[model samples]
Every structure is written in structure tokens, then in C-alpha cells.
Target: MMKKPAMQKSKQWNIKGAVHLAGIFHFLHSCGSGCLVPFLTLYFRHLGLTATMTGIIMASKHLLALVWRPISSVLARQYDKRRTVIVGSLLSSALVVLLLLLFPSAGIKAESGRCNTSQPSADPTDGSDFTTLESINIPSQSNANVYSVNHKTIITEQPDELSSTYTPTLVNSSSNWSIRAIRSLRNLEEQQEEAPHTEFLGSLKVMDAQQQMFFLVLFVIVLWEFMAAPLEWTADDGLYEYLDFVDATGRHKGVKVWKQLGAAVGTGMVGILVTKLYCRTGTVTEFYSYTALMILTAPTAALFPLYLRKRERATSGGFKALQLVYGNSQALLCAITVVLTGMATSAVSDFLLWQMQDHNAMEIHMGISLALAYLSQAGFAPLAGRLARFLKYHGWLMVLAVISLSLQCLYYSFLWGPWAVVPAQMLAGFSTGALWWSVTSQCEDIATPGTEVTLIRLFEALSLELGAGLGSLMVGFVVQKFGLKILFQGISVILALWSIALAVLKWKIPRQRRINYSRLLAADTSEVSESESDQEKDWLETAMEDARQGNKWKMDKF
Candidate 1:
């Protein structure tokens, strides 16, 4: 049996190792794939693409990513994870570097450094503004790479014979192009006139800046998956809230795209963090001891999963031992977890939105909401720890938390109108905090010993992303269709029903209780004569069984 000090050392090493590798992949992904989605629309516009065209491109990108998610999951399941991580990381990084290097400029260029495509040139009826051109042979070029300069639109071409080779096409034939050009110039003049009187938005500018900040933040704290994804999701919600509001005014579309980009990267970071944390630490709070059990297990749990083992052992050994009944039951539970957590979070933000009834108070709302949300996460950790002790069954604890928040959210949802959403923020605070506690702690029970915590954490990442994605879409739809009240009511009912289903499953399991740790370890040591294969299997089984039982008496009783 591993001694206490030795186990502690092992756990520390594991945590460190997982953090190191996870950080590297997280950095690469954040800078590469992470940055691309946000800047895509901006880049498209830089190429003079219309808003409609840009939107179509972005939709296609999202659709493709959605299509690829299942494929990614399958690859994760079938291939070696290390290989997958390495390939995805390198490829994503290389693509980003290549794009920036090849296309160094982000916007259009003109003969005059300051050029407006929307503007028409000065009147050329007289000789002063117009220069007569001799009819010359012009080389052929692709129309795609051309843009209008001064009074002429032109394309560049190379000649087969050498000498001088480029040509320009001037369309002065019917004056139809001139008519269109004059109409565009009139619109530009009108836009310039209206630019000053439009409503100035302090919240939106801050929101956009926050979005840009999150990208750098993800790169800085890529080591912890939990840090990136959760923070990013929350940050995205904040960014999106403003985007939704400003959509009412059409002028700020460019700013709106930037805000969404921030949200994506921030949320993506959160997803990465969740998975990495799970792989390394058996407990979610491996980095912190906000939960009592994490504190108890910190000595070993934090350090155990770090060292790189033979690939076979990391994958094959744990799978044989865990033998989890992964089917409809697990899916149902994961879904419930996603929906409840999502509903609770959305409700809180919805409440904040309602409270900020005045345009002037928006910044105050943003600051207050963020300060309170962050505080609640830190403050509620200990309370969650105490509750975990009272409710030993991971399933029951999760259910109770969900049901309580759901009912509370429902109450706030139907209370009045906009004012009702304000009081609901408390439920939001509690529910969001409670979710991290339940999901992470529950993961402790589910993960196999000798299995990389990365795998379980990856599941957590996926669930959280699915939750945020679904939640945003659902809340937006409900608010638009049946109104805010109906959305809250729907979430309430969903959470309550899901909780009961999970509670029922928990009762059915009837876990076989084990003795305290010292006695268990003593027994384990005595049984060392078992074959090597059997010994490893026995260790993995016992560790997980201990997590499920959460019977800390084993350590203290000895």
C-alpha cells in the first residue's frame, strides 16, 4: 500500500504534470481556434464583404463546428488522447500563425492611405480633374481581386510576353455603375450626418473591451480548465446581453460582432479548464479546499494523477475496472445537470437585465452583477462543503440543489414583471455556486482510479458547453415567444423532473459500503500476494469505491 506521505507526493506530481500538458494545449487552442471564431466576421468585413455575406459565412462556420463536434467525440473515444491533443493543438496553432503571416493587414488598401469605398470622386467634366488616356492593350486578370480606385475600378494581370504587363477596366459605358456609385455616396453622406446624435452606450464599449481581455486572460491561465470555461461562459453572457440590447439599434453592428467573439473565447476557455481539472484531480477543487472532502483528499488526490504512465494503463486499465453502465441513464443525468445549471444562471442574468430598466444605470448593473456573482462563488463554497457532509449521496445532493433552485427560480419568474427578475438574483447566485459543487464532487465518484482525471473532466467540459449553448438559445427563444415568465416556469419544471429521475436512480444503485481507509489499506496491503494485474485492478476498484462512499472516517478513524 502507498504510504500517506508517498501518496501525497504522487498526487502532487500528477497535478503538476496534468497542469503542464493541459496548459500547453490550452494556450495553443486559445490563440488558434479560439481566436479565429471571434475575428472571422471582422476579417470578412475587412475584405469589403457585406453584412449579409459576413453573417452567412459565420453561420456556415458555426454549422461546420457543430457538425464536427460528434466527430471530435468519436476521435477522442477511438484514438489515443495524447495523439489527438498533440495533433489538434499543433494544427490549430499553425493555421492561425499562417493566416496572420500571409495576410498581415486586416483591412483594405487604397492608392491614398485614407480611402472610402463609399465616396465618389470630384467632378471630372473639366480637364483639371480628368486625364485623357490612350487606348492601350491590357493584360487579363481575375475580377475577384479588384477594387475601385478614384473614378475607376480595376484588376491587375500579368502578360505572357514580359515587358509591361498590368491592365485596368474602367466602366464608363452606360453610367449605370455611376448611378449606383452616386446613390452609395448619398447614403454615406447621410450616415456621416447621423453619426453624432445616436445613443452612446457605455455598457457596450465596456462589454467589447471585456471580450478582448478574455482572450488574453485565457492564454495566461490556460493551466486550469475550470478557470477558463466558467469565467468565459459568465463573461460571454455579459457580452451577449449588451449585444442583444444594441441589436435594437443598427449602427453598432461592428461592435456587436467583437462582443460575441469575446464571449466565444471566454466560454471556450472555461470548457478547456473543466476537462483538464477533471483529468488531474479526482476532486474538482483540487486547486482549492472550499469543499471539506477536497481538503481531506488534497494530500493525495491533488498529486496522484500527474505522472505520465504507459498509454495502455492510462486508457485500458481504468476502463476495465470502472465498467460504468454508460447508456441512456448516464445521458439523462448529464442532460438534467446541464439544463438545471443553465436555467439557474440564465435566470440570474435575466433578473439583472430587468433591474437595469434605465439606460443610465446599465454600468452600475454590470459592476454589481459581476461583483456579487464572483463573491457568491467564493462565499458559498464552504456552505456547499457543509451540505455535502449532510447529504452523502452525490445523486441526492445534486437533486436537492436543483429542485430548490428550480422552485425558487420559478417563483421569481412569475412574481411580477421586470421587477421580479431582480429578487431572483439570489437564487442565481446560490444555483450557480451549487452547480460547481455538485458536478465536480459527483465527478469524484464517477472517475476511475488510474484513469486520467482528464477524461472525466472532458465530460464536464462537454456538459458545461452544451448547457451554455442550449441555455442561451432556449432563454432567447422563450423570452421572445412566451415571455420571460414562461421561460422561467419551463426551466423550473425541467429541473424538478430531472432531479426526481436522478434521485430514483441513486436509490436503485444501493452501493456496497466499505470500511474506513486505514482498515481498507491494511487489507489491501495484506492482499498484495495477488497477481500484478489483479493488484492494479484491486487498487482502482477500492479508490473509486472510497470516493463513492465519501467515507472520510477511513483516514481519521485510523
Candidate 2:
């Protein structure tokens, strides 16, 4: 009797220590990618890719996740190699950053030679400063990348100010190009008279260089997504397995708050690094920081422990996770809700930076806003579990998340300047922190016991990726045709309506507390026949037996 009590005490201590160690790894992993992921759109635009092109490349991540994530999860499950996958994925992420670093960059500032230089603010009444400045950089040589100030030009050729990592923006007919347009045209004509062929050749070279960079960036992103697809799901799946081992899954949300904290630190660090060095830095600071952090965490991931129970159940070998989604209406609804909300959320994640750029928001504004947003998530994440209790149903949490997504779109739609992003993003923190907690936790609750291979059900994540990819691909076109402001407003309205549809559908469809652990894995598309069902027992019965065995054997130690 005394030995039994002593063993229980020792086991409790072991679980406590194990979870804290796990939190440290989670913190480092979140910090690693937080440094660069948020700023990627700005990075692409700086490289002279059009908005539509950037969107397609960004969207490829989610679209590709459909293939790679599943494959990664299966590989991890079969080989019991979750730790190996995590380590490999993190190292791959670091390599991707190093490859991106080989290209010259200067924060998010436009490179001097690129045609997308920011024009100086002019008093519309005077117009002289704008006109004269536009003529000075009118390419004494023909190096046209097709951007002009109202078909005019602009200048700031200081080597320190014009590093290759600068963003060049499009100028439309609506731009304030008056005397500057005329002066730029006159200078261009004279320059062309002297060396027309030379200018033409230079333009060809510039366009060729831009094209090369565009393709290179796209290729890098594609490879990066494929290699890193396993990182999050694999890591989180391992974490969940560990939690279940200790019977401490309740503390999962509270521990995950550490991730938000680490992300806040990393994002704040890089945001400050980039914003402060917008002119002085020759290298992309975020990549260096991101690489260092990823390297820092890879070793921990390699050694992380995972729990893989023996397949003692009769219905073991098939895609039971898939059948859960198809047979259950509530689970299916959860998938749909996640996908639609994922698309709406993409408006803020992928393209909000474009809107901020249009408002002349500086790096500091971007950095500070996003950092605070992350911090807000960290602050609020612990409360989500309690809030779910008050809200009664976990599904209500989804409705709240949808509402938050809609409000975020509405805020960005009417943004006046960069400073507003700071406050607006605070709400984003809750959406990601509390709301995201709600999204994943609710799905976790809905899944049948012992079917987890990737934290949430596989279909839940797939639906999310599908929504995000579709959103990014289509949102790019809207930004191209209607502009960023109009795009946000439209998305806000559409998402508002979507939230209502979800609420109504959720009301009508009953939530599936635990899906039937079916015996007919081979006939996933077909219903289980009574005769076949009679031969087999529900997975929960086996899971209970496994639990008794696990307690008796004390871990079935891998």
C-alpha cells in the first residue's frame, strides 16, 4: 500500500516535469517560424512579383498541404518517427531560409534600381518637389520594369536606401502625377534620343532578372511547404500523445499558451530588426533570426517522446479517421465551418500587409501591430478553456470565431493608416488564440477516442487547407481588379453572412460527441453490414481494454 502511494507520487512528478519540458520545445518551435512567415507577402512584393503572382505562390502552401501533410502523418504513424519527422522538418525550414538569404535584401524597403520607389509626399498646391524629384531618377538608361508615376518616374538612388529587398508599388492614372509626368516624359525622350538601343537592352536585362527572381522565389516556397508540412501536425500530435500518457490533456491549452508567448517574442524581435534597419541592412534580418531559431529547436524535436499504443483493436488498419467525417453530419459541419472561416481569416493573414503598404505603413507599424497581436493571443489563450465552459457547447466557440473573423475583415476594410493595424490586430490575437483554441479543441472533443494520428482529425485540417488555398487564390484576383480596400469590404460582408449560415446549420445538425468506431474500414464508402458489425466490437471497448493493459503494464514502453 505504501509502495503504491509512493509510485503515484513519483508518476505525478514525472508528468509535471515532462509537460514543462515539452512546453520549452513548443516555445522554441513557434519562435522559429514566427520571425518570417508573417512578412512573406511583403518579401514577395519586394522581389517585384505582381500581387496575383504572389497570391498564387502563397496559396500553394495550403493546396500542397493536402498531399504532403497526409503523407507525413502516415509515415510518422507507421515508423513511429514523429520525432524524426519534426527534426527533419525544422532543419528543412532552416535550409529554406538560408537559400532565401542568398538573395540580397534590405528589410522591406524597395531597392534603388527597382522602378517601385516610394514617391515623396508633395503639397498638391506646390507639386514642384514631386515633379523635380521624379525627373532625377528617370533612368538616364532604359531599364524599364514597366512602373511609372502616372507613366512618369520617381527617384532615390542612395545605395544604403535602395537595397535589393525593397518594395516597388504600382502607380495608376489616379496618382498625383502632373508636372512630374511631363518633366519625366521630356527627360525620357532626350535620354532615348541619345541611346535608344542601349536603353532597350538594359530594359530586357532588368525584365529578365525580375523574371528569374520571380520563378526562383516561387520554386523555393513550393519546396519549403512540402518539406515543412509535417512539422506542426507531427509535433502537435506527439504533444497530444504525451498528454494522454499522463492523463493531463486538460492542461494542453494552458501549456500551448507558451507557443503564443514565444511567437510574440520572435515576431517582435524581427519586426524591430526589420523596421529599424529598413535602410541600413543589406541582408534580410528575419531570415537570419528564423534560421537560428529553427536550428535551435531541431535537436529538441528529434528527442521528443511519443506514445503509440499497440493496434489491439479489430478495426485497426483502414482510414477510420476518414469514415468519421463522411458518416457523421456534425463532424462534416465542423469541417465546413473550419474551411469557410479559414478563407475569411486569410484576408487578414495574407493580404492585410498589402493594404498597410498602400497606407504607407512603415516596418515599425507592421512589426509592433503583429507583435502585440501575438501577445494578445498569449494573454487570452488560458481563458479559452473557461470560456468554452460558459459558452456551453464547443460549437458556440466556432460561432464566436466566425464572428471575430468577420469583425476583423470589417476593421481592415476601413483602415486609415498603419497605426490602426496595431489595434485591429489585437482582435486577431483572440481569433487565433482563444478562437483558434476553440476551433481545434472543439474538434478534438468531437473525435472518437484513440483515432488521433495528427491532433485533430485529418479531414478537419484538409478542409482548412482547402479553404485557405481557395481564398488566397481568389483573393489575389480581387486585389488585382478591385484593389485591397474593396476586397476587404467585400470579404467582410460575405463572411458576416457566412457566420450566420454556420450558426444556423450548427443549430440544426446535432454534434457528434464520439463517432462510431466502425469495423468496416475497407468499406469506408459503404455502410457497415449488420452481419459484419455483429462479428466485431466497437473500438472504445478495445480502447478500454488497452487502458487496463497499459495501467497493468505501466506504459507498454516503446
Candidate 3:
């Protein structure tokens, strides 16, 4: 048996190993998936496809998920989380690689029939091949092989076409090869001009129309994951708008336009730090601390769980770890909250604008709201990951969200005009950024028994997508029927109640008791027996032996 100190050391090492693995896993997935959001539409345009088609194709991911979620959840619950993760990652990656490879070939085929180079061949023996030769020489039949004429060089001719005094003559082919070549060249030039101006779009231009469509679909799904879905279901939207108000108000004219530039510098700095620290520390503590910093900031930070889920699958195939942490119940609850809150908020906003019979006024409010919405989601995603690490639980985070949203709504309702949303935006920024990260972290933290990470993630994903789709549709119906105040009032009540529910849940699962070992380790033995690879078992055994030999400590908490 291992000594006490050795056991402690082993536990510590395991937790650290798991955390580090999780962090790296999250980062890579986020980078790959998130990069597409800002560029997908342009990619579609490059393929000469329409926006309507783009939207339908993009929306299909969610539709596909409707099928995938239940199946994924059941499989994850029954099988290994890691295997599920591997399957999902491989599925997505294979599709991506296939698309990249398939695009160019498809594009070439698309251009194939439209362009060609060869001209029809002519036969010299054909009657049509012989045009009347006005200037010709006749040669004696006996001298057909070699004929000569006065002041003329000796020439040879076929026996059938003997000419004495033979003079050299040239015949132009029936077709103007040069003119056809020029026209062909001109067509090529026009194609070059009309090939959708793909240069500015980079390599995506080389992709085929179907691949472009695929890309648009995948990208929109990714965006919905990061944007409309997460916020609509969670209490984060209020925070997002509020923060946008802050950033907008905080900046002057030039700063707002150049905001992404500033963001670029900041992102670069964070990337460097993440790379450096992940390389050196390679521990959960290091990963969490770094993630905390990003999460608290909002946008990039908000993307933490997504980053974690994808990366974990990519690197370790540890989808089970995620499943053990956040299960179906929590996912269902989160989905309910998202749908209800999104519907309430959107309906309220629409009703209020309609009450005034001011469509333009509503549009202005929504425009600012939409812009702010986009800014926080796009700008602070990395920061949100960092914040999630810092905060630890959704319950405490929810309190903060409620307070910030309440303040912003009060401003919008009474204290401020549409412009008043500016100062209140900061509250939104903080809440949204933190809320996004915290919710994901909590979901990961509270997985129920036998849940796989993939199942949890898919459910989380489906909830967000379905919720947003439902919210948009439902809110439209409500606003058309009811007045604006009623909508706002309903949203306020639902948001407040969501805050309460979260607070209660948090009270039951505090920071100290955050980790749920029962769920996490519930099927530890069975999992080890069935799925743990020989290599993984050997590593664990070595770690255990090291602890027994007084070289390491037990590591249980991660």
C-alpha cells in the first residue's frame, strides 16, 4: 500500500494532470472553431451562394443537433466519455479536412465545361480541306518527286499533284486559330475577373460552392454557440447589452472603430501567456488562474467551456470527465432558463417599442443593443474563460448578473433615454462576460452520474440553439399580440426568478463543496475496466508506484 504522503502526492499530480489536460484541450478547440465566426459569410459569398441559402444551411446544424443530442447523450451515458469525445472531434475534423480538400476539385469541375482550349482538327485529303489555290505550279508526271522551274528552286510534290515550274505557296487553315486563341484568352481573362474576387477572402475562395455552403453552416452554428444561443438561454444577454453600453460610452469616435485593433493586441498578449504558462506549469492551478483572468473580461472568457469541451476531446478523449461533472438535469434547467428569459426579454423590448408606434425608435434601440451584443461576444470571449476560472460557481455569478441587469433595465425603463444605456453597458459587460464563463464552468462542475461530456455539451449546444430559435419566433408572436410594457414586465419577472433559482442551487452547492466526486467517480471502476487504454493504465500504475515509493503524493481533487 502507498504511504500517506505518497498518496497525497499522487492525488495532487492526478488533479494537476487532469486540469492541465482540460485547459489545453479547451484552448485549441476554441481557436479552431471560433476563428470562423467573423469570416463565414464572406466565405459563402466567395462561392457565389446566396444569403438565404447560407442561413438555411447554417441553421441545419441545429437541426442536425436535434438528432445528435439525444443520441450523443444516450451514448455518452452508456459508453466512455472519452470515446464519445473522440468520435465527435474526429467527425468534425474529418468533415473540415474533407471540405478543405474537396473545395478546389469542385471549383475546377464547376469551371470545366465552361472553358476549353482545343479546336477541331482538319484532314488535308478532304475536299473541304483543299481551298482553291490561285497561284500554283504544274510539274511533269515523271518529275513529280523533284520539280524545277525557271528562276525557281527545286521542289518535291506528291505524284497525284505533279507541277512543273513549281512555285512555293502557303495555305491558311480554314479556321482562324489565332482569333480563336485570342477569344479563348479573352474568356479566360474574363473568368479571372469574374471569379468572385476571392483574393481578399484568402484560401476560402479556392473552396467549392458546397464546401462554402458547409463552411457557412458550420460557422453559423459556431456563432450561435458563442453568441445568440448562450445568451438567450442564460441571464447573460442583459449583461452583454450593459457592457456594450460601457465600452461604447467609454470610447470616443476613433476608439470604437479601432476597438478590434486594441482587442488584437490584447489577444496576442493573452495567447503568448497561455502558450508560455501551459508549457511550463502544465498543471490545473496554472490553467485555472490564467483562464480566470480571461473569463472575468467577458467575450473570449465566455467561451471557456466550449474551449474545454472541444480540446479535452481532441487531446485526451476525456469526455467522461466532463460528463461526470455536468449532467442532463443541469443542462435541462439551463435550457429552460435560456428559453424563458430570451423570450421574455425580446418580447418585452419589442412591445415597448410598439407601444410608442415608433418603429424607427425601436430600431435605434435595437441597433445599439445589437451592436453592443456583438461587441461583448466577439471582443471579450477569451476574457470570459479566465473569469469562469476565478468565479467558480454560477450561483454567485447569477447574483452579480441579476444586480447588473436590474440596474441596466431601471436605467432604460426610467432613468435614461436610449442613450442612457451607455453607462449601464459596463454593468452588462461585467455580467455577460462573467455569466458566460460561470455557467459553462458550473455545467462542467455539476455533471450527474453516468453522463458523458459530449452529451452534456451537445445538450448545452442544442438548448442554446433551440432556445434562441424559439425565443425569436415566440417573441415575434407575443409582440404582435401584446403591448411592450407587458413583455418587459414578463421578462423582468422571469430573469428575477432565474436569479433566485440559481442562488438556491448555489446555496446547496457552495465553492467548498463544488466538486461532485460521487458523480465523477461513480463508474470509475467500470470505466477503468472497459475503456481505459493499456497505456493510460500503465501511466496510472506508474504514478501509483511512484507514490508508494515516496516519490509523489496522492492527487484526487482537480
TM agreement with the true structure for every prediction: 0.40, 0.69, 0.34
- What value does the lDDT take at residue 314 in candidate 1? 20
Q: Candidate 2, TM-score vs. the true structure?
A: 0.69
Candidate with top lDDT is 2
CA lDDT, every prediction?
A: 0.40, 0.67, 0.39
Q: What tens-digit string does per-residue lDDT give for candidate 2 at 1-558?
A: 355444444434366666777788888888877788888888877655667877788788888987788677767866677777888888887887568755532123343422323765556543222222212233434534343443354332322223335433433434545534434444444555556566645553333334556667777888888888888777776777678777766656556677877887777778778777755553378788888998998777766656765533234423676676667776677667777777776657788877887787766677678778878877776576567667666577777777776788888988888797766787765565555666575555445667644336454465468877888888888888888988888987887787798889989985544433442343453444443343344545766899899897876664
Q: After superposition, how far is residue 84 of candidate 3 from its true place, in Å?
A: 23
Highest TM-score: which candidate? 2
Across 394-495, the per-residue lDDT of candidate 1 in tens digits comes to 455567667767876677555543233345444543665566566555444444443323334344444444444445445644554575566667878877
Candidate with better TM-score, 1 vs 3: 1
Candidate 3 lDDT score relative to the true structure: 0.39
Candidate 1 matches the true fold with a TM-score of 0.40
**Which digits, one per residue and each the tens of the lDDT, describe model 3 over residues 46-109?**
3434334444443454455444544443344334342334333433342342232123211111
Q: What's the true lDDT of residue 248 in model 3?
A: 29
Candidate 1: count the clashes: 20
Please state every model's RMSD to the true fold in angstroms. 19.9, 12.8, 24.2
Which consecutive 10 residues in model 1 have the weakest lDDT in total? 127-136
Sort by lDDT, best first: what order? 2, 1, 3
